[model samples]
Structures are given as C-alpha cells and as structure tokens.
Target: MSALTVSQEEVKRLKGIGFLNNKGTDDFSARIVTVNGKVSASQHRLMADAAEKFGNGMLAYTTRLSVEVQGIPYEKVEEFQKFIAQEGLTTGGTGAKVRPIVSCKGTTCQYGLLDSYALSEKIFHRFYEGYRDVELPHKFKIAVGGCPNNCVKPNLNDVGIIGQRIPVVDAEKCKGCKKCAMEAACPNGFAKVVDGKIHIDTENCRHCGRCVGKCPFHTTDESIYGYKIYIGGRWGKKVSRGRALDIIFTSEDETLDMIEKILLFYKENGKKGERFAETIERIRFENVERQLLPSC
Candidate 1:
C-alpha cells in the first residue's frame, strides 16, 4: 500500500474528532463514544471486529466511560468512522464543549440511590449530543454518582449530580434505644443520641439516607429522595474540588432545567479559555450562585 501523510492542522482537527496520533508513524487511536459506560453485547462484538480489522486488536476503556481502539493508520480513519456509524456509534468527545456524560451502574448496585444510568443517558443526549458543536471557554465535563459513595467522583467534574436520600426522623415512633440506629447507619457521624433521643445534625448530614430502615422502631423515613448539584469542579494538573450548592432538585425535569441554565450562564459570563472553576473563582462563587439560583 501507499504511505499516508497528514498536516499538523489536519492532525489537530483529527484529534478533535476523537482521533489521536500514536507514537508509530501515521498510526492513530480512535476514541469511541459510549453512554454511561453502557454498550450492548452486539456493540462489543462490533468493536472487537473493528479493533481486529483496522487497529492493533487492542481496546482500552477511558475514565470518561468511553472506548478507544489504537494503532489504526491515518488512511483508514474515514472508513473506520463509517463502519462505527452503522452501529449508531460516533466520536468527538474532545473539544471546548461538553464531554461525554459518565455514571456508575446505580440501577444494579446495592448502594445506589438512583438510576444513574438512565439519568446519565438523558444528560448524554440533551447536553453531549445537543451541544456537540457549541463553543465553550474550555472543555466541560459532567458526572452522576448514585449516592454519597461517589463512585464516579462527581465532585471532580465540571458539573456533578449526585443522588441523595434525605432521612426524616419520626419522633413519635422512636424507641430511644441505647444504641440508636443512626449511630450505626450514618456514615458521616451526623446521627447521635442526645439526651435519650436520636438527634440528626442537619449540617453534617450528607442526605444519603443510610439510617433509613436501620431503626428497630423504623423511625427513619425514606420518602425524600432527590438530586444535589455541584459546580466549578475539575480534576486536572490543577485540581479543584467542586462546591456543592444548597439546592436539592426534587424532580429530574428540574435538575435538567438547572443544568441547562448553568450552561447558558457559563457561556454568557465565562471568559475565553477559562474553566468553569476559574470563572467561579474569578467572580466569586456567591455571585455566580446568585446568578444561577436567584431565589436563594
């Protein structure tokens, strides 16, 4: 076959479209898209075939819940993209836009408090797919954690959504046992026995509802389950943990609306080449919070 040649500008464009130049001459790696780390068995087989055909028969999983096939020649990129498109797969998670949405397997996990896969898929479609071409100050990332376990490390992403279960104590049914259920169930030590009664420190509570059903008297109520949002977080060379907002969205629609508003606000107020975390720091989180949640 003939040798493949590409320009520096073309390589940059290719990287934006999910192709990365490998160490080998003219070889590239293709980053395939996946939704919340979910892929069907058939899709896996297709990936295997693609890897064997165009790549070095190797596949790697990205921390962002995507797949990459390495060692494909530059000449085959167009053909490889077309082959993956037949299976409803595409590329382009890199750029100054929203990256792929990631989530843990909340639906099947014992400690999961919400359907993270479903919620992440919704986010993937609405934001990742919707804002595929929209320019941003820097790359944006989003993560959904099932509960306070934070398996997906929501606090390390640009936008973090964590499922929360608020525990409500029913004093009427309290047995007032020596060893309160909250003491054992609460992971953050927010629950304690105070003067022969169970006291839950609201400020320290993570709202994970670990105390629910732990009481012999069944005093912990698990009726309140919602989502907590954190903004201005990023994990990189300069790491900054996101700050959690006081707002708890009661419905998925509300959470989705809030995220959309956040994106719009960031687009309007953020300076070029600045990350959301930097923007929050520059303008002060309080001022940004006021703009995002004026009712607060």
Candidate 2:
C-alpha cells in the first residue's frame, strides 16, 4: 500500500467530475447532486454513511442545492461514488457546465406561486444532465424562486426563473371599501383606492398577485401564473445582479424552451474564459437583449 499521487491536471479533471481537492492534502471532497435541495430518507442514510466512512463524519450543503462529503482520500473516490450509486445518487456538477438547479420550497410553502421543486428538477434533467459534456468559459448557475419574495435569490444566478401571478381585477364585482383589502395586500402599493374603487397601477405592479386572495369581495382574479426570466446575473469577486426580461413564460414547456435558447445563444457567443455576465457587458445588454428577444 503506497500513497496515491495526484497531479495538478488530474486534480482539475477530478474537480470537473465533482471531486474537489482538499487544501494541503491529497484527499478530495465529493459534491453530490441533489435536485432542488431534495433528498429522500434512504438517500440521506447512505450519504451519512459515506461521510462517516469515506470523508469526515459530516456533510456540507452547498448554495447550489448539492451536498459535499469532505476529506475523502484520493484512492477512495471511486468507491464512494459506487456506494452512493446504489441509492441513485451521482456526482459531477462542476466545471464550465450548467450547475445544479437551486429552488426554494415553493410547493409546500404558503407564499409559493409555483412548484419550484418540480421546475428545478425538470431543468436539472434537461440542462444539467443534458449539458454535462458541454464546455463553457465559466460555470452557469440557475435558480428558481417561488414568488416575488425571492427566497432563493434568482436574480443572483446566471439564469433566474421567478414564479409570478398577475392579478386581474373585475371592476364589476367591486365592493370597494374605504380601506380595500387589495390595497393592504399589495407589497408594492400597486393597489390603490382611487375614487372609491380599487385601482391597480399597471406600471408599478410587479404582478406578484399578493392582492388576489386578499380581496374581500374576491374581485382579484389570478389571470396569469407563470415565470419571469432573468439573464446574465452572477455573484463572485465581481458581482452583478441579473437583469429581468419582460418575457413571462405562461407554461413550464415555454420556460424550458426559453432556457434552452438562452444556453444555445451563450454557447455560441460567449467568449473563451469569460463569464455570461462578462459576455453581456462586452457585447452590450441591448445587443444581447435583441438576440434573446427579437420580437421585442
């Protein structure tokens, strides 16, 4: 039994496969992919076993909705991978490829507008697994937030999908009280009591639909429930918040299509060793906007 020797190039390659080299040691840390931060009871048990056996007796959760088992010896990496495989878990959410999709607990949360877990799962399978081999200048991050509350901070990712609800008020059903419930419900103050009626300021309304269930008379109708997309946002040494696009995808299928298109556009136009944010800056947001939304 001799000590295993790992070169720098091997370390880089291993990192691309989700094995991060531990500082000042030949040991590695394994990042286990978990879609939208979900893990079953049995899977959790296996992970705990791996952590105790292969690495340190602890697991670390990443911001991108994955788990890392630290302090794995370089030689036991393959064995650990096999141990997790019986429970249907895999690694490799690193490198320049699309990273694991992160999402807030939208389905179970009271403030949720859409199923963030489901959406994130779809994106993970469609993009993360699908684009595992695709090389890019920088890692692409995607996040899904359930509502305007932005619990997951979608605006901080390379691609952000925010669930939105556009309230449609029926003026005929108005029993406009002096202090309308809609007015009180609106976080942005978009709903106003004007001339004894509740008037929603279209310009100012973020379409969060907080007023929908709050209207005492039930005048507010959720006419639209969809996703608001943002692009080119990242947090790093040079942080830039993503710009929200005017486009609102009405369906999950439409949202997935748009995501594919954005990735394709980035793959083609993004410069070598430059992030999507940098690409947006170099080519100008207006130009990228035109390419992303030609109809607009």
Candidate 3:
C-alpha cells in the first residue's frame, strides 16, 4: 500500500463538508445530500455526470438515503460541489447537526396510512434545512415510516414518526354475526365478538388499521388517522429502541412543532458529544417529556 499524504487536519475539515478520506489515498468520497431521500431526474443526471467527470464514476447509496460519489480527488472537491450546485444539489450530511432524514415508501405503498414522502419532505425543509447551520450536542437522525410495518426502521433512529389508523368501533352497530370479518381482519387478535356486539382491546392495539372496514354491519368501518412519534431511539454499535410519546398527533403542524421543540430542548440541555438518546437517559425521560409536552 502507499503512505498517507492528506493531513489529519485537512481530513477533519473535509469531513465536515461531507467528504470522507478514501483510506491511504488523498481521494475522498463526496456524500451528496438528497434531502428527504429524493432527487429530481435532472439532479440524478447531474450526479451521474459528477461521478464520471470528477469521481470514480461510481455512486453509492447510504442507509440514510444519501448518495456518495467515490474516488473524487481532493483537488476536485470544490469543483464537484459547484457542479452539483447547478442542479440545487449539495454535498454534506455530516457533523453533530441534523442528519439527512430516511423515509419509507409510504406515499405509494398499498398499506401506507399516510403520505410519507410529503411528511418527510416537510420535515426536511423545516428541520433539516432550517436547522442545517444550528450545531447540536451530537448528530440527530430522523426517520419517517409509513406505517407500523416499519420498513424504514423509524424506531431505530434518534426520532421516528410512524403512521397510524386507529379503528373507530361502533359497538351499537355490530350485529354479532356468526362469521365475523373483524376476527379475520385483526392480526393482533384483539378484536373479539361478545354478547350482541364486537369489542376491540384498544390498549394492546398497534393501530395498524387492519381492522378498519372489516365488519359486516359497519361496526369498524371508519378509522382515525394519526401519527405515532418515538423519541430517544438510537441505532448502530449500542442500539436503543425509542419510546413512543403518550399521545398520537393528528395535526401535521402540531407534530412539526413537537419535533422542533425536541431539538430545541436537546440543544439547550444536552451535553456536547452526547447523543440525544444518552441525553434522554441521563436526564430521565419523564423530565424530558414534561418539557416537550407542556400542554399534556
């Protein structure tokens, strides 16, 4: 192998700008920010051009839905950034700030209860871009899952948002039919038929919406769509499953405000070099919850 030439100081600076040193080489990988895991077709072409002209003609996808162009010589880093900038694309998803968000395909997924792309895109602009320059205690990650299927593993991120469709059970409308569609629809076995009506064990329900519209007499015909937020979740070496907030938010604006509040709280209270999860653990979730949820 060859000896390293890039100084540690330069590497650290470049890393802040989303460039990672290619071990033993002065070359770097340019991590392109795709906002909410999405890019326009023209931007796609621009990235391809950047790879061929400046990088190693290869692009790799990140777990956070970022794109990395490998083997771009150090000298071309600035030029690479400028080239992508023409299409409104930029390189950088690093540092102890808000990282790029990961979104599930809830927009078009059949089982999706909400428009995940829209939600993630909204968050990208509100927090990711809005707080891009605001440094935080540590890297904060956000993931938007379409439903409880959790394809994007929202619960494993610093903060996660999953869609929910809680069934509205009309007990009086239930006919207590011998052959119950509710029983067949419920995957959790919480929906059961009793004397003259249907009952759902709401406490144990995941609110997956599977039981919705599954009754003969329209007992479970409607559902209330909402979002379930999980906080203090972390992944990687030492993983921690995030805990869900006590209430489900039905308004998008309300949810966005809550997210902003969480970040603001962490910014003011979290110790430097500590992850959000660590801060939550050290401060105790109850204390943090009180601050995040002032109304309830």
Candidate 4:
C-alpha cells in the first residue's frame, strides 16, 4: 500500500476556527489585537484570560510582534476588540492596510548590528496612522534586518530594509594569517587564503557585518551607512521573489520616500486586486523601476 500525501487544505483544516460562513464566504472576518514592545509575563496571563473569556483561548503570534484572535463572528469583532483594548491591547493587522512593521531581534543579541526596536518604532510613527484605513489590492509585508544574516529575509518581502556597510581591507597591514577565513564562522565562506594572503570574496559574503566582528586583526570596515532595498515579493498562492530596488545611502527619510514612491507607482499602474509582485510581473522590472525610481 502506498502512503497518502495529505493535501495542504486537509492539513490546515481551515474550518476548525469557525470563522467560515455558512454559504462559503471568505474567512477574512477575524479581528486581532497587537501589543508590542517589552512583553511581560503578566501580559501572557492576561492574554490567556481574555482569550478564554472573549475569544477561543487561541492566540497566534505574528511575525510583526502582534497576536491574532480567530473565530470571532462578524458582528462581535468590534466588541471583542473593545474588550481586548481594556486589557491594554487593540485591534491590528485587520483590513487592507499597512500592518505592523517589524524588525529582527536586534541589540538584545550579540549578533545584532542595529537597533531593531528603535527602527520599528520609527516606521510605526511615520506611516502607521496614514495607512490604517486605506485599502489596497492585497496585503503587504515589510521587514527590516540589522545585518545580512537576513533574520527577516528582506529579499522575500514587498519592501525590505537591510543594514549594509562597505568593507575596506588594509592589505599591507594584513599578516595573511587567514583567521578571518578559517576560524570565523561565515556561512558563505567569503574569506579565503589565496597565495598565503587573506582574500575576501566580496560576492560570496552576505555583508552580514559578522566578519567585521570576527576578524582578529580588525581588517573589516564598518564606516559605510544606508540600506539595500528590495521590492515586489510575496509568499502566498502566487509566490514571487523581489529584486534589488536600489543601494541607497541616506537618511531614514530617503528610505521611506523610496518605499512610498514604489507603492504609489504600483497603485497608479496596477490593475484592481493586483499586488505589487503581480504588477511587476505584468510590467517588466526595468520599466517599473524607471517609472518609480527616476533618480536611480
């Protein structure tokens, strides 16, 4: 007998949440509550209590420092959210708007280069309210990374912000010990000993900024500023990958401007219900870039 291959739908058991309607309506009627920043043990207790009281006692942690409450009927969503607000939480990630922006766990860990929490705050303060009620063709996801380790997988998001620093090597000062290559734990094997000299494979290295910390002789450089942006990526039914939008070296204002420009371009040119990736696919990458990034 052959083993059965379970279908994804069967495995998911979508109707288990009871959000589905009787006539076959989409399961987009659920409301969520988001509580970010320093999460306390007390918060967990409250969440559990509230879930059992008002919700299904089921909580789902989102990638963007929020939680979802499924199974709430359409009529009771507002009331559920109101009850949740009393417990210091409010509805978020509900509707076709900019969801909570998130960043990798940075600063708390040794591997982190930038302050993720602070950056997330910046994004929220700048654009969150503006997008609260605005409708769009599809859901959008954005993530920021402090380094090239890709904790947020910037290459796979609609808009990805990754910290980057140009490495400057001092060849004359280098002893050719190859410690950076041999001992350092680089996933891409960027550093290597060529002709008894330490050679950094720029292409292979993810520019994760780890090598800068691992180098014994302090050969790695970290003076450069700015981020690399990617656009038009998503992971749902129509899986698509984004491409490098640009290598921008400027203030946070510039980065946000670029993102808004791309979004606006998509809104103007894209068909109804078409996502950023779909628009990109419909129009060639070059044309899209040319229209969006005229300065590039």
Candidate 5:
C-alpha cells in the first residue's frame, strides 16, 4: 500500500497553532479518529460536532455500521477525548486488537430473542481493557444477531453470535390450517399440508421460528439452545467465511468470556500476521475447537 501523503501546508498550519506537538509530546504519536453510528439523531449530531472539534472534519462510514472522523493530531487527543466523553462516547476500538463489535436491535423485530443493546454495551465495556494495545496477527471482526435473519451474517465473521428458535406446535389448536406451510416458514421444508392437516417434519427442521411466526395457534419459543459459534471468517486480503465451531448455550457474559479465551489462544499460538482463518488452517479446526471449547 502507498504511504499517506502528510500535507506540509496542513502540518505547518497546525504547528503554527501550537497544538501540533507540545513539549514532551511524542513526535510520532498516532492521529486520533472518532466514530459513532446511525443512532439517535442527537448522538449522530454530537459525533459530528466532535469531529469538527477533534479532527479535520473528514468522516468515513463503514459497512459494519459505524462512522470514522479522521485527521486528528497527537497533542490534542486528551482534550478531544474529554470532549467526546461529554457526548458519552469513547474511541477504544479504532486502533487494534478488537474493533467495535456490531449488532442489531431486538426491539424492532418479533423474531429477535436476545437483547442486542445489552450485549453490545457489555462486549464494548468489558473487551476494551487490554485489547487497545494488544497486537493481533490480523484484523478480527465480531458480529452478533438475535435471530436467523442473518442480520449480522454469522457465517462471515472471525466470531459471530446468531439467534435461534425452536417452535412447539399445538396440534389441537393448529386446526391444520396450513397457514404456516403455505408461508414456507421452514427453510428445510419441514412443514407440509397433507390430508388437510399440517404435518411437521421434525428431522428436517432447523427450528428457525418462521413457522411459529406464520402460525396463529402454534406457539413460538426461544430455543434454550445457545448460539452457533463460527470461526475463521474474513473479507479482505484472504476473504473466507468462518465455519461453525459448535452450538453454545446463550449466556451473553459467558459467551464474551469464551471469545476472550479464543482471542488469547490465537495470540499465543498463531504465527505472526496470521489471521484467525490462517491460524485455523495451520493448526486444524478440531484442535482449535478443543482449545476454544474444551468441555464440549
């Protein structure tokens, strides 16, 4: 990749303001960039104001549902952070080991089972410690979702959390209406209408909750079963989607703990600059899974 061209005129202008590099400031201190997302209009505006105060007013958005404000100099970083804190935001994920985790809200959908906001906040707060400075062999991405709508694309991240549901049919109330069957609610074609009666093929059903959504009488239930963990997915350079590690129980806090374990394991055992996928390919999936989930 080509080196960034530092505008001499811009540098001179900044230096003239006495804010470029103060006494004792590291000459090579990296520039600070701020970011937020499409949230409450108020927060979005607050982030924009922060960019005006701390950066060069250049903003960039990512597909992962975030915005980046760039061109911040070194000396004013502390002041910039203080200013952002007033807006109730922070910038730990912009630099390294773990980036800001992306997730979708459960409030907007009936299919959603877990609280995504709580999950996002918990992951963000807990994972920030030690991750900012820790170097990764390659950039890692994490995405979580509340259901099988694939909102976060579970199969396409270094780590992913996907929601699942197992539906229970009340045959007495079902009336064999076949409403669920007609909607094609089951991706596996598990539901069928025969003899004017709705029959569910349990063996083929993935229990994705669509049938429940379509049926008025059949009740829907969040599967006690946890999320399906995926490993080794990435997009850039060596693009590859992660494969399923295993089905884990849905404990948000515990899941984060497991993620930390995986990250640490990768750091200790992976070759320098090897991504999670590359590492998995080298060490073998079973060994990686054993390290990630020893009990199962």
Candidate 6:
C-alpha cells in the first residue's frame, strides 16, 4: 500500500488474464476458471494451498462460479498461476468473449428435467474454451437451468438455456375416471377429464412433467424433453428480459449450434462497446429471430 509500484497500464493488462486489482493496495486477486461452479476435491485443495502461499490466505467466490485467491502481490502473480497450473487449473473469464458457464443443480433436483451439469460442461468446453480467442462486441454470459424453476436465472444472461418436459398424452389409453389422478397431480390444474377424454390445456400447461404417468389408465404416460432458449437477456444497471425462441430444441446439438450462431451474429453485426441485448434491440428482435430460427 505504500507507494504503488505497478502502473495503471500494467494493472489493466493483468485484468485481461483474470487478475483483479485490490483496492488501496498493490495486491490482486487471481480468478481461477471453473465450469458450472464445480471442481475436483484435489483442485479445491490446491487452490486453498495457493491462497495461503501467494495470496492473503482467503479465497473468494465469484457469482459466475470462479474461485479467487485474494491478496497476492503483483510480483507473485506468475508463481500463483504456476502453482495452480500443476492441478490443471487456470485463471481467466474476463474480456469481450464468452464468460464462465453457469449451471444450476437442476439435474439432481426433483423438478429438474435436464442434466444441467452435463449441458454446462459441454458449453464450457465448446464455447468458453472454444471461443476463448474470439472477441465479441462485449462480454457474453451463458447459463443453463435444469427446469422451469429458473434456479440459475438463465433469463438474466445473454443466452439462457432452460430444460423443459412436455407431457405427451395417449388419448386412446385415457379412461375419463370419475376421480382423475392426473388432475390431482397437476399443480396448475391444466389436466382434466372431460366427456370421457383427458384434456390438457396446452396454453396453461407448464410442461412440468409432474403429471406424466400419473393417470391410472396410462393416459399421460409419456413426455418429450427439450431445451428452451432465451436470448438478449441482460441484468445490472440496465435490465432486459430475454425473449424465448419460438421453437423448443429437442436436440442438444441444435441448442449448442444456436448459441454459436447467436455469438457469430453478435460478433459480425454488433457495434463495439454494446451488449447483446442492445444489438438485438437495434437490429430488431423480429428480424434477428427470423434469421436464427430454423423454421424462418
């Protein structure tokens, strides 16, 4: 803290590599990259050792799921990086590229329909690491949620992927029971028996899959799993709720490709210093959607 030795320019350069300057001190925090907020037990232990060895002996967690070793002097940055590197860890998640991928614990949760952890792993390897060098108009953030629970706040990111389970009814198997189990199981009352047939209000059904296989007659016995994508969502000083694409991607490949296409669109058409939401607004969501969606 006595006499700043590191110049402002040098600090900016360090930030590009995931080192954040500590206020009122020459110390910096090294942000270690993490995928879906998960790391091996050995990785965690190595970070703990690095925190005490080169940092202030304390570690901080970022909202994006990266770990930070706080209080490392400017000179010890390289040493800290190397120490964690032995465990195959690295420091990054800054700049105008894809930020860290976030995954909710939806896959393990009772309501979860998708494997949030696995999907996020694909995103991290495919985009976060794959697009590491591809600069965009601004930082791009991605989040994967396992279900409609929105535990990860996917709608708040630039690109959000949420899992969905749409119930498929076998009308021939339905028996319009006097006391319908599907009706009782449906949290939203979207399922009902009318005139010897079970009807699902497509407009109101949340596709939560809770009612699937609930009917005694096996009427609602099957379901379709899909991913709902939202684009152009932003949060902070200015907030923009992402718009859901018209189609529900039944294949993971389509969802992943959609993400890449959106990134490409932004990279080519977006203006410098503008967020993806702003770009979408400028170009008009209607036009953007038409180009991105396969049907259009």
Candidate that would win on lDDT? 6
After superposition on all C-alphas, the RMSD of every candidate to the true structure, in Å, is 1.8, 2.0, 1.2, 7.1, 6.5, 1.5
For model 1, the stretches where C-alpha displacement exceeds 4 angstroms are: 1-4
Worst 10 residues of 5 by lDDT: 27-36
Q: Tens-digit lDDT track for model 3 on 1-296?
A: 45668899999999998999999988999999996788999999999999999988999999989999999988888998889999999888999999999999999999898899999999998888999899999999999999999999998888999999999988888888887899788888988887867888888888999989877678877889999999999988999999888889999898888899899999999999999999999999888888888755
lDDT of 4 at 272: 72
lDDT of each: 0.89, 0.88, 0.91, 0.62, 0.63, 0.92
- Per residue, candidate 1 scores C-alpha lDDT tens digits across 122-183 of 99999999998799988999999999889889999989999989888887787678878678
TM-score of each: 0.96, 0.95, 0.97, 0.77, 0.72, 0.95
lDDT of 6 by residue, 250-280 (tens): 9999899999999999999899999999999
Q: Where does candidate 6 stray beyond 4 Å?
A: 1-3, 194-196
State the lDDT of candidate 4 residue by residue for 64-100, as single tens digits. 6676555444455446656656656655564445666
Candidate 6 global lDDT: 0.92
At residue 199, give the lDDT of candidate 3: 82
Candidate 4 clashing pairs? none
Model 6: colliding residue pairs? none
**Cα lDDT tens digits for candidate 5, 1-296:** 23435455744544432224322333312222222133566666876786777666665666565565565655565676677666565544443366667777654677686676666667655654447667887666777777767777766878877766656655555565636543476766777876766677765565466766466654433235456667888876568878776655566667888878888888888787778888998998888888788875
Worst 10 residues of 3 by lDDT: 1-10
Query: How far out, in Å, is residue 252 in model 2?
Result: 1.2
lDDT of 4: 0.62
Candidate 4: Cα lDDT at 181: 45
